[model samples]
Target chain A: MINKESVIHTRNLSRSFGEILAVDRLSLAISRGEVFGLLGPNGAGKTTTVRLLAALLQPSSGEASIAGYQVGIDDQEIRRKIGLLPEAPGLYDGLTAEQNLAFYGAMYGVEEISQQIKRYLELLGLWNRRHEPVGTFSKGMRQKLAIARALLHEPEVLFLDEPTSSLDPQAARLVREFISDLKGKGRTIILCTHNLEEADRLCDRVAVLNGHLLALDSPIELRRRIFGRKVVFHLSATKTEFEPILLEFDFVNHVEQIENKIVVAVDDPDTHNPVLIRALVEAGAEIRFVGELRRRLEDVYLELMQASEGIINGTN
Target chain B: MERIKAIIIKEWREVFKNRFVFFTVSFLPLMITALPLVILFFTGRSEDFAGVTTADLPPQFSSLCSGLDGAECMLYFIVTQFILLFMMVPVIIPMTIASYSIVGEKTTRTLEPLLATPVSTLEILVGKGLAGVIPAVVATWVGYLLYAAGAHIIVSNPHVVNKLFDPLWMTAIFVVGPLLSLMGVSIAVMISSRVNDPRVAEQISGIFVLPVVGIFLGQTTGLILVNQEFILWMAGVLVVLDSILFYFAVQIFQRETILSRWK
Candidate 1:
């Protein structure tokens, strides 16, 4: 179901380069004020998808719209409504930071251009070095200046390809925080990144792609859907008898015993864990500690990618 | 229009910082202006030409240097040979700059972001074309002005100076100079859009100057005499060629082809 409030919408968007299909017939919608992440490995069409939706490349056989403007047909109107920070930070190294922003600002038809430039530069902590040519700037500094350039026009939709790909922890954290701040302001951002942890934190939802949509959902939901809720119960002793006690409950889907612990998979752990604990206690099982197994997004991503690879290899 | 202006300003800012571009635009014109004046200065002061008559000159000079004495006619003929060199100024300087424009942007990875903007392809081509043409045209005009000033100061015969400012040479400088610069810029831009290396683009663009040099050779060898009719006809041919090249440039510089194929 497509949300009525979706700011970005696409249906069967596909793009191909001669013999290779960069982006398949992928369809997805991004709602307003959502931070959506596009995650995929090398040659997975993450960048091509962004380019297609940004109207930088025409779709081979699909349709997309940004802020009510159709892609390809209304490319200029869409371009006017969006800001894009390409993968390279693509700045003029010979020009000063201020001059660079001023150039982009003018291209976007931004009014009060100086004020807009000052605001973004100061926000990115680059105002002090605004006069310096970008050639002298460090990698992190150039990335920040590129970010400032992307946000100078206060675009309605921003497509950032690897926003924090090659930055120090501090710089990456600064960018992450800035993205959070933008989220708070109700700005819609489509982020493309290889850092799954970053995507898990920043994205309201993420789409994992390998030339086609492999999976799309919130991180936690995907975790739950892929590797259902597993609750681990630690006890003084693990006996074969505890397994049957957990199996006694119809709510428990599976149970495993590992030496001194019991791992149980349930549909709703919050509602079913207590009943299983009571049954285990009655079975003379001493529960020392009971905790849910925490799964990282990395695990989910690896599982999905491996499954997709198996399907592609005809081994699934 | 404003977006085009922004691109032009940005291009000028970047172009001015290139030392090679600065040297080409500044020094080449100065050299072209001063070289002819120096030769005229020496020819006007030479003692060997004191008694030489038009009878001593080649047959081709009989009709071209009509009212002048032998020395004056010799100086006028020598100065006329530099007219084609003056035309080469606009062609050479803009080629140096325009050859680097698109290919340089691709090398630096700035083309994608610039193309992502609301500005159209035509605006970018126009902006870049004007950026190259303006400087080359300005340099040629300034060089011509200084040459004229120095000629009037150095020549004793007013007729020689008058002949230097004839309709043929004036049209060559004022009219054909800009059109040739535009043609050079269009060809360079077209080549720049396809090539990966700016040096390769420049090297290939250098082949274009041969035709103009061929004309210069023909004129100097007395095989073809340039006059008002020839200047106007050349301008007409350049106008047609500029339009065709500009159209092809726009066709070749497609955003999809550039972002995908120009690796």
Candidate 2:
């Protein structure tokens, strides 16, 4: 039986290929029914981490588990419980979409595999053309079939590596929505992708990894902790008059007013935003709109990569 | 066992769907078999072709002729010599199938998803190995059977038929043919695992047939005689070699190698 807590657990898990350390001393815990994202740049061990946890590749040292089964020892067991959509959909061009799904379903020992195949193919909007060879389908359709193959066994954990990397915007949206739907069913998912926006929207907690875990937190928490908080307030009155009053709070690092909008950078917007709002209203500045101007997850990701580089260069 | 069966079924589906591989595996043996018959048909009809007598026949050819006339002796010699060419079929057909199936999967990037499954490496290799070997074996036997029946019809002399259907040729085509196919599939698989290009694997695997060609050359040149004893001994050697090659083929087929090493 799978552990109710921490469907995936790792302790200092590391893997090296000759001189190159693909994944280094990684440790993490992902609870059941959580959608965790592994955010990384190319060659940052994101795929390697997924492969390691999926039991496709064994770690050189340390230990890891999927659904309470040890990675190396219970590799077949772990594989039995996990599904993977690799960077490439890797479907056989000669086989039909339904045949491809049936092949994988049989390999995973999925019972009533034809029904499972039909279910996933229909869910991905591929039931209409399931009999057509995958080679005849577009890239997005092939990817959808690959996704269906991964979920055919109804695996306990799903690992998606760059699920929408080469897809067009509309196709990407379909795959993202499908992933969101999977999350709604309380499925445990580990998505490794470079798309920060998708990660932000889907992942409950994103782990920024570059060979190791650099930052692991909710997207909102990561932005607040790394870049601090900046709240933007638009007022009907000219905001130049409210700057001094907003700066009175020590947590407010800087206050800038551009026409009728006040942009305040604060250490903690959750605590200071309300206090600043009350003062703004008390002073009789007509507030038209009040909202937090959070930093984009992309900016946070780049900053983290740059800081990690600085540490690697011994300049920090 | 079911996983292996699934892989084998998928492999057959893929092989048959590929026109070039399917044609090569199914028709190449027939083409090769036709080559010798065409040569025999023309060699018998050509005005310049002088029929050799029993005294003029080579020592290796004389044994097959035994009590035949001069023209019959010539046809007997031709039929026996062409059987050596048939051996190349098992090697060529299976090598073509195995190299293309293994390396073609790599080129298509389909191997990754298959590797990610819990199917053991042994099962995958065996499944693929049999998929290639079965068709080649059947083709070899089928082509041989066709050639034998055609030779009986085309060659009027009974001596030619007698030499073509000898126990030695029977063992070579039926027993040694499948073993050579196994060896060919194993060598192709080993090369396929190391290389990403199917063409490269196919070219390198062609080297496995050089020794068989040497035997062919030796027998035809009267340097080494091919008799029933030689056929039985060769079968023994091939069965042992096939087992060893297959064992190595399985050992070398690492899922990690396919997943990580090959780009």
Cα lDDT for residue A265, model 1?
Answer: 94
Which candidate achieves the best DockQ against the true structure? 1
TM-score attained by chain A of model 2: 0.94
* lDDT tens digits by residue: candidate 2, A203-280: 999999989889999899999889778899999956348888988888889998888899999877788878988999
> Which residue pairs show collisions in model 1?
none
lDDT (tens digit, per residue) of candidate 1 on A1-316: 2234999999999999999999999999899888899999999999999999888899999899999999989999998888888999999999999999999998889999999999998998999999999999988899889988888888888899998888999988898888888887777899999999999998889999999999999999999999999999999965545787678788889999988888999999999888988898888888999999879989999999999999999999
Q: What is the TM-score of chain B alone in each candidate?
A: 0.93, 0.89
For the predicted complex of model 1, DockQ is 0.84
Clashes of 2: 0
Task: Give the DockQ-based CAPRI class for model 1.
Answer: high
Ten-residue region with minimum lDDT total, candidate 2 chain B:
B44-53
Computed on alpha carbons, the lDDT of every model, listed in order, comes to 0.88, 0.86
